[model samples]
Target: MGKKKTKTSSTETSRTVTTPTRPDWVDAQAKGLNDALTDLGRADPAASVAPLSDLERRASETAGGLGVGGGWGSGWGSGGTDWANWGRATPATGPAPAATAPDLSGARLEGRGEVPQAASVLDNLSAYMTPFRDQVLAAAMGDYDAEAGRRRAAQDLEMAGQGAFGGSGAALTRSLTEGELARGRNSRLAGLLDQMFAQGASLSAGDADRRQQASTAAAQLGQAREIEQAQLTQARDIERARLAHEGGLEAARLAQAAEAGRMQDALARAQLGQEGELARQRLGLDGAASRRADAETQARIGAQVRAAEQARLSASEQALARRIEMFSGLPLGLFQGSVTDSQGQRNGTETTSGATLGEIAQLVNSLTGSPLSRLFQKKGQA
Candidate 1:
């Protein structure tokens, strides 16, 4: 049989494992160092190269056949793992899901690209107790030592500090003069700041005086306004009292005027009533005059009756006298008898003087038979 062959490292053989990257602390630390070196290159490019080259060499030594990746690899979460099974539980009620079988097969055959990431090698190796002798391994001592790479990287970083100050002797002299000018400018700025502070103090004092005066004026104005308000209230009260008094006086005057008017109307009514009574008294006087006239007419009628009786008596006396003359050759005894008869007739007429109109006419007819007829006939003719 041939001798067993050892697996040569990436330094010796260029072959790399092409699988998903796993957690490897040594390789992560090397990469971190290289990335820091690249960042330094932006500031000073020449200073970064030496440290970067040594990092690459040490990375190859430690992580020889481990192919690395670009992104940060987090672990497979439970939520994504659950989705990878896909619709298995949903289809169990009926027939099995078609997607369920396919998803399961896919997960097994075409493996998901995921891995657990490790921390940096610096975090991993920091636990080791340190000494210069144990830190840098000699070339003959160990097959895997990043000691030489670490030393070269340190030397190159020292070189970078000097590299930041690159160009020459004449520039240094001008830089010194620039420093002096910068100091002179700072002194002038300090003087200006002092002057500004003094001006600010003066401004503050002026503002304080103005504020005090404004405060006093505001207080005085407030007091004056209060006085004016008090006076206005007093005036309003006085006006109200005056209006009330005037209203009472006006009401009294109206009442007195109304009473006077009533009194005048009553007097007029009384006078009118007295005039009506006077007119009634005049009417009563006319009635009295009519009664007197009636009484006078009655008295006149009585007088006419007496005259008629007297005339009848005289007619009887004349009749007796005529009879006596016819017996004139005779005696005094017949004359005496005639006188006695006439006297008797006169007493009878007197007794019948208050007789009614018909009775008086009847008496007159009996006494002067043809005489009253002739008289009535004669009056009618006349």
Candidate 2:
């Protein structure tokens, strides 16, 4: 079988990135700042720093005096008097008095009086009706009696005219006539009595109606009065309750105001204390900063003086070394010579004059084992 075709591919990718450069002025400014910092670093501290003003000098002197004379330095190390207690004390404020409540005992309402009694229409009814009935009956009976008397006189005259005055027939007729008249009179009298009684009864009934109307009016008036009294009492009670509530509210308001005033006073006192403490701490910090600045200034001045002295000493030593080197370069005379004798013999002898430059160089090279020893020896032989 044929092998499957295989293919391989390779991909390459490339990208170019461009970076933005700073402006010339920016670079110049940076370079200037760097050079300025370098020069400041190399400059003398004493020359760079300005002299203290009069105020600052006085402050420094005062601080120094306090440190030495007032035991301020010792106080810090030995836990003595602290600087925090150097201010005026705050005054204490008292609490406000409580409010008084109003009296409520006088607000109570009084009890109402007893209710009025109702009037009766039948009161003394019998006595008043009896009198009226008797008067009417008497007037009716008097009229009946007068009528009977007139009739009896007329009958007697008629009997005399008829000639029956003293006979049996006349007596019998007179008796019959008297009897009829008596019957008629009795019937009339009875009718008159009935009418009188009816009138009396009507009067009594009218009086009773009047009394009943009066009694009802009185009862109505009493009920109205009672209602009015009840309303008045309720109104008074409501007014009392309102007055009591208002008094309580006023008392509470006064108390709240007093409490608020006390709290405000307390807060003011606390704030005053905090301000005093902060002032003290600020003063201490400022004094410490002033002392530190003075010390640093003195140290800088001393360092500058020491550096100047060191530079002067180094220059003097360099000058002395140069003089020594110049003197040493000059030729000295200490050399040995050969003396001639008879029969061509030579002997060693010391020379009094100074040696030549080559001899001195050779002597120095031999002593020091210098690289120039060969040149000096060759020159001396030449």
Candidate 3:
């Protein structure tokens, strides 16, 4: 099999290859210095330092003097800023004196001052100025007697140089070993500083990766929460709809029950109406019976009136039959042999069957048309 070729992103390639980037410690240190300088610029515009190339000659001269001075905080002496080789402090033991008056006898005064021509002044003057000249001459030749003072001055100068080279902390060390380590790139300290600076840069990369991962995780969590909330809201809405449907069903069931109850009531009322109709029919039947009874009573009274009229007519006819037989000289029997006249006389056996129809008609009219029949008619009305 052939060796497989793989591809990688540009960012990974650069990291593995150790491409040039600012060291974290160095970058941090520079950022801090720039910030300080910016603050200084705000406070004092005129006094602000420019880049070395941009500096004026006067400022450059000032930097050189301060940086290379051999006294005070400088390398040649021990004191604050005021210490100098010739001007500020001269030792009392070696070459410095409190009072040394000038000579006037052998020297002539220039301009307007009068001369002092006294031998006594000249004799005492040697005692005062002799030390002064010797001190000046000895200093000029570098003949300092105190080895401690010379050593201190050299140490001070060396310390000040270290401050200038190592940069702005203005480091001044008491030990030669510390100064030596600070001055050059040496074995142990160099290795230690390199490892610390590399770790600092690596720590920055780790922190950046951690921050990116946290952002991605937060986004995912937010999406999950939105989905869960939507599902919950949908479930709640469904439950509400189901409850409303159940309520509607319950209402319908109640309405049906009420309608069935009404139907039952109507059935009961119809049965009662039938019972009432039957009762009315019974009453009508009783009233019809009463009317029939009334009619029967009236009929009976009519029949009795008819019989009484018949009896009255029959009795009157009977009396008439007896009188008719006597007048005809015949017996009142149904048949007789007689010859009869107006009076009661007989000649021979004869049958007088001939009666006057006119007379009988008259008699029946008188009886049938009597006040008694009229009274019966009035009873019929009642």
Candidate 4:
């Protein structure tokens, strides 16, 4: 046999390539950050937020201009809405601020005045502002200290540059130069301290001014919001008054409509009942007529049956009469016979005989081949 050549499989011939790999933790962190960013990009804030319906929007519009800033409920009206409990006022937190009824004579709003928003803003200042002040102070101190450190480092570098490797005379001269430079640096550091102190004072004064400006702005904003709320409340009251007036007319119209609907329903029911009664009467009449016709047909059928039966009976009676007449024309004999036995008892028998032997033959012929006649004939033959 010739030598066989072996073929290598394609998978075995294929070379495996190795690539550079990153640390598992590094890859995992990068992947996680990428996934987080992707998810954030895809996320819809509106999906989480409930959307307002058209009706709700209308109600909100009717109540007040939407998105009016500040505490709308606090200054003018109540918290939440009155729609949940219609016709009722919100319960008061304290002894209900005595309401001053508006004077209709001038048509001017009552109790509406300039509210001090500055005082309100200043009231909460210490809680939030302390941290901000502390931060600013820290930043200024750090900057001052860093500048001082840089100056000190420069002085040390200068002294180091003046270092001598020569004899005592050179050392003394170097020492003199270093002493003067140290004095100058100390003077500069003192001036730097003074500058830092001045800067700190300026910062403090600026912060105070900023707080004052903020307070004034906040006060103005609050007053503006209060005015807006009062306007909304006034509009709401006007709308309520208008609706109240219309409500009375609506109630009367509804009452009339309800009464008319009830009357129409009653009329419809009466018509339906009348129609049902008519249908029932018609059905009853139709059924009675059908039954009467059926009864007449049955009576005619019964009469026909009776007539057929009477005719059959009459035919039978005539046939019997004709047979009787034939027998009457023939000579029929009544034979009386007596028999005596050895016991000395006498027996007598009576038999009716046909008038002719031909009649007797006819009767025998009619009974011929019957089971009882056959038996008698066999006996006679035997």
- The residue ranges of model 3 lying beyond 4 angstroms of the native Cα positions read 1-181, 185-195, 211-215, 222-226, 260-264, 267-382
Tens digits of per-residue lDDT, candidate 3, 159-213, equal 6776654543434344553555344324433554455445544555555566556
Question: lDDT of all predictions, in order shown?
Answer: 0.41, 0.52, 0.42, 0.47
How big is the positional error of residue 376 in model 2, measured in Å on the Cα after superposition? 99
1 or 3, which is superior by TM-score?
1
In order, what is each prediction's RMSD in angstroms? 86.8, 63.6, 86.1, 54.3
Q: Assess candidate 4 and give its TM-score to the true structure.
A: 0.22
Pairs of residues at least 3 apart in sequence or in different chains that clash in candidate 3 = 75-156, 75-157, 76-153, 338-350
- lDDT for 302 (candidate 1): 34
Tens-digit lDDT track of model 2 for 1-382: 2234444444444444444443455456546556655765686756633354333343455456444433312343244744344222221211212222223233333443344344344554456557645686567667777777787778778878987778898778778877887888788767766765676566666777776777676666766766777776676567556655654554465445545544544444445454654544444454455445444443443343344345444443455456556644644222223343333333444434555777766677666555576665678799
- What TM-score does candidate 1 get on C-alpha atoms? 0.23
In Å, residue 154's CA in model 2 sits off its true spot by 4.3
Ordered from best to worst lDDT, the candidate numbers read 2, 4, 3, 1
Candidate 1, overall lDDT? 0.41
- Residue 160 accuracy (lDDT) in model 4: 66
**Predicted model with the maximum lDDT:** 2
Ranking by TM-score: 2, 1, 4, 3
Q: Which wins on TM-score, candidate 2 or candidate 3?
A: 2
The candidate with the higher TM-score, 1 or 4, is 1
lDDT of 4 by residue, 111-220 (tens): 43343333233344454445544675456556656765676566556656766345575567556756765676576656655655565555565666676777677667
RMSD versus native structure for model 4: 54.3
